[model samples]
Target: MQFDLAVIGGGVNGAGIARDAAGRGARVLLLEAGDLAQGTSSASTKLVHGGLRYLEHYEFALVRESLTEREALWAIAPHIIHPLRFVLPHVKGLRPRWLLRLGLFLYDHIGGRKHLPATRSINLHRHPAGAPLKGEFGPAFEYSDGWVDDARLVVLNALDAVAHGAEVHPRTPLTAARRVDGGWELETPHGRFTAAALVNAAGPAVLKVDGLLGEAPEYGMRLVRGSHIVVRKLFDHPYAYFFQLADGRIFFAIPYERDFTLIGTTDRDHTVGEPIVASEEEIAYLCEGASNYFKTPITPADVVWTYSGVRPLVDDGSGKPESATRGYRLDLSDKDAGAPLLSVYGGKITTYRHLAEEAVDLMAARLPALTGKAWTRSRPLPGGDFPLDGLEPLKATLTARYPFLDAGTVDRIARAYGTRAERWLNGAEGWQALGKSFGAGLTAAEVDFLRQEEWAASAEDILWRRTKLGLRLSAAEQKALADYLGG
Candidate 1:
């Protein structure tokens, strides 16, 4: 089929770009090598905040754009996106009070924040947020951010794109793309899709596509591996904790799901030629970081689950891992160095909407018939037509309708799927009607909805993407799920 644009990779970037393009009246097709968001897009830190730390590196533009997007995304997917308060405890030697205070000040005012609250100082010795912390630490500060269901955000964007005239296919890997006529003919495991414009949003595998066409960019990509650990419940507070290590880098201990605390993220240079796994050293380091701050220490035994992802950052010659630019760059390449092949590099999930708008804008030049300016900025993402503040009413009405669903399950599904929960329910009677139960509470009906509506092709795709049950289910349960899916 001919398309105005063909996007490779079903990750958030590809999905977002395709959605924007299709909404702007461009015929678009998005192909994923595996299930949607099975890659790095599913395994993010899950924060939609302006990189509060990026301000430390003087990344004003990236921080500004990302912060502005935080409110937009929360507005669009309020159920899945919500405001999170982070507690930044003051350490004696790591960072001075003035520096942290200044950072928080810029974090609030730097980005034109409207919906989120401003930062406030907290007495660690007195405030409950710091009761779990070591006594020696001085007062701390609290700031606002937005947390997202990182993977489902990608799926919802793809769903929106599909609703807006985009062909979204999963488990359909790209094979090759050779320039044909005035456009590009792309071959995938599924079939051939011809397009005048091609986009490489393959995350780590971006250069792989470039190599196939001998049109790779001049700069190489750095694959930085990051890992996170989910431990048994740590605290009862709703606020997330951010601690700076003695080594100057920072790590977070956030209240995750209901019965666990999520801690993570190490930035080590890596080269993953195959499926990546978390290094033992990385796991140990995370535990040690956790031990250093919390009054109650946790060991490796406390960690029930672990996950890792490779961040595909454009190598901007920054020697330090933290120095790499978080901003994305669009490179247009072609067979004869003239055709339009847009390859995206180094972007965060929070800023995807603007990036998609920009991608569509560039592709519009290739097809002048596609002219309507950007509409996605204002369009509700599928069920997001209702104001985010109004979700409580929807939840009240849903619970009143189906008392069988536990508060957790209903709230989670409502937040994850938003107003579309009705379609998933499809007049089901109760929990049993929702289908067989997975250990962490996801049902077969929810799983089927993932497969039919969200492009989930594998158990991992459903468990990890549409939901984070992978972190909550036991090994036996996971195995049963794998077997149930015919794995």
Candidate 2:
């Protein structure tokens, strides 16, 4: 097949670029080695924030860009994204109270704040968020950020790309690519294709893809593995936390899946081929860190689930992994180098849309078919056309329409599928109409919809990536699901 652009990667960045380019009139093809977002995109801290800790690294431009995109992303994908308040308690010795105030001051003002509330000082002694914390923690700072269903965000972008006439192959890996007389020739497991331009967004495998094209690595990459642990609910309040350690590191404790507390993110240098599972030491470190703040002590045995993702960060010679910059760079091949080649390196989820926009903007000059104007910023992704504050009302509508579904199921459906929930619910009057129950409100009808609409072929794709039901599904139930998928 021939195309104007061929994007190799199905993470958020590649998917976002496909959506933008296809919408702007390019014949686009997106190829992924596995399921969409099976890599770093799915395994994120799941926050859409301005990176408060990055300010300490003096990444003002990156932080400012992220802060600016914060609300814009929330506005476009309100169903899967929503406002979250973070409580940063003051530690007596670490980062003085005044510095925290100044950092937050810049955080609120520099980002063009609008609908979200401003940061405020809080008395942990009187606040509900303080109830589970240690008594020594007195004053705290509450700031605004956002939460996201990271995997779902990637899927939604891919769906929109398809809606705009982009061809997306989830399991097809790009095996080879070479520059030719006016464009580029690409080889994949499925078939051979040609394009006028190519984008390498292979995340941690970026340098490997460059090797496939016989190109030298233009920038250094620091692979930092961030590990997180999920445990039973530690606090009853809705507020999440941002905590600091004497070691000059920071982590977050966020409310997750309604029944669990998500604590995480350790920064350790990681080699490319090493396993991505959270190590016992990393889990114990996070558990012990949470213990120091919460009244209840957390231990490794308390962890119900653990995950880790390697960040492909630009190497700036920072001694510490956490100090590395989150900024991204786009490099286009010189005109004498034949067809255009754009390679993306080092970016975070919060700034993906802007990164995609810049990438398309760079490719537009080389490919004339990319003549249309930029339009992703104002356009909502699939199933995200409602008002920014309309999530509650959307949930109410789902409850009223599908009264047979329990409250938990209704909430899950509303959040996961948004306006598209009705597409599968299809006015089913009872649970039996939805077909066999697989535990945790999953049904044959929902699974069929996922397999048909989304690219879900296995139980892991449906349970872990499409939904977090893997945490609730039992071993027997999971086996049954796997058997049902014929895996």
Candidate 3:
């Protein structure tokens, strides 16, 4: 189909841009090579923070923008985003307490943190979160950030884009594209499409997508692999930990999926062709990093699941992977020559929305057809129409309405779909109405909703991205899901 805008990736940036542009009255088309968020978007550290550590590298602009987005995102997607308290324990040889205090003071004041609490000093000996930490670490700093279901965030954006009259195509790769005088002729396996503007948001393959048009940008990209591991619950509290390593890098240990703790994120240079696997060394590194602070030591053997994602950071001559900037830049391809091609480079998950706003603003300036003002700031994604603090009350209402479903199931569904969960339920009278049980509370009704509404195609997309049911499903259950979806 012909359109005013064609987004090349289904990750957060592409999805966010499509949603924003379409909402502003542009005819937009979003194309994904695989399922939405099947790459870096889903495999994030799953946070909506302002990059507190970025202060060390003097990225005040990025940190300030990200800080603002923390609350904006939580405000828009409360079901999938919520405030989180982080404990940054004060170690002896590491960053000094005064420096930590000063950094946190800036972190609090940098962005307007209204709903979330401000930073405070915590006595580890008395705090409940300290029970799991070693005695050597004490008097930690507590700060406010936000947590997110990264994959769901992207899906919700895509859903909202579609709702705003944008055409979203998953698993449709752009095989070739030829730049017209004032538009683009894109060839895909499905069909040929034309657009007045093209957005190169292919996360790790941003450069590759640009090359499809027979040119590359003036900038460079550094592919850094970050890995995370999931282990049995290490602590029994709602608080998450930010641990500093001796090598000057930092990682986090956060609660995950109610039954486990998610520990992660090592930054190292990785080649393009390499598989996205949590290497033995990386797994061991994360385990060691966590064990240094937690009273109960951890090992690679204790890891139940591990995931890895490569960050396509802009190469700014930083010597170490951790020093690369998380900020994004919009490169408009020689607009004076022809229709504009906006290539997004080097962005973090926390700043996707802001990047999208900037990208679209640039697009509007370059392309006359995309005449629209900045929106999406106050617009909520699909299912995110409720108040910021309405999740618990919404859950209560859902439970009261559907008493037949267990509390856990209701809560899971509510968190996943927010106010829109009712759309999936459709006032079902009882469990039987949900249809064929695939185990782990996954039913045929839910599967049908995923397939029909959320662009879910395979068991992996349903289990891993759309929901984290893969952790709860057994081998047989997963196979059953795959077989059912296959048939």
lDDT of 3 by residue, 201-314 (tens): 998999899899776775799999999999999988999998899999999999999889999898989898999989999999999999899889999889999999999999
RMSD per candidate (Å) reads 1.7, 0.8, 1.0
* Candidate 1 per-residue C-alpha lDDT over 24-51 given as tens digits, one digit per residue, 9 for 90 to 100: 8888999998888888887888888899
TM-score of each: 0.96, 0.99, 0.99
lDDT of 2 by residue, 120-189 (tens): 9999999999999999999999999999999999999999999999999999999888888788899888
Q: What is the total number of backbone clashes in candidate 3?
A: 0
List lDDT for all candidates, in order.
0.83, 0.93, 0.92
Worst 10 residues of 3 by lDDT: 366-375
Candidate maximizing TM-score: 2
What is the full ranking by TM-score, best candidate first?
2, 3, 1
Candidate order by lDDT, decreasing, is: 2, 3, 1
Cα lDDT, model 1, residue 479? 80
In candidate 1, what residue range of length 10 has the lowest lDDT sum?
331-340
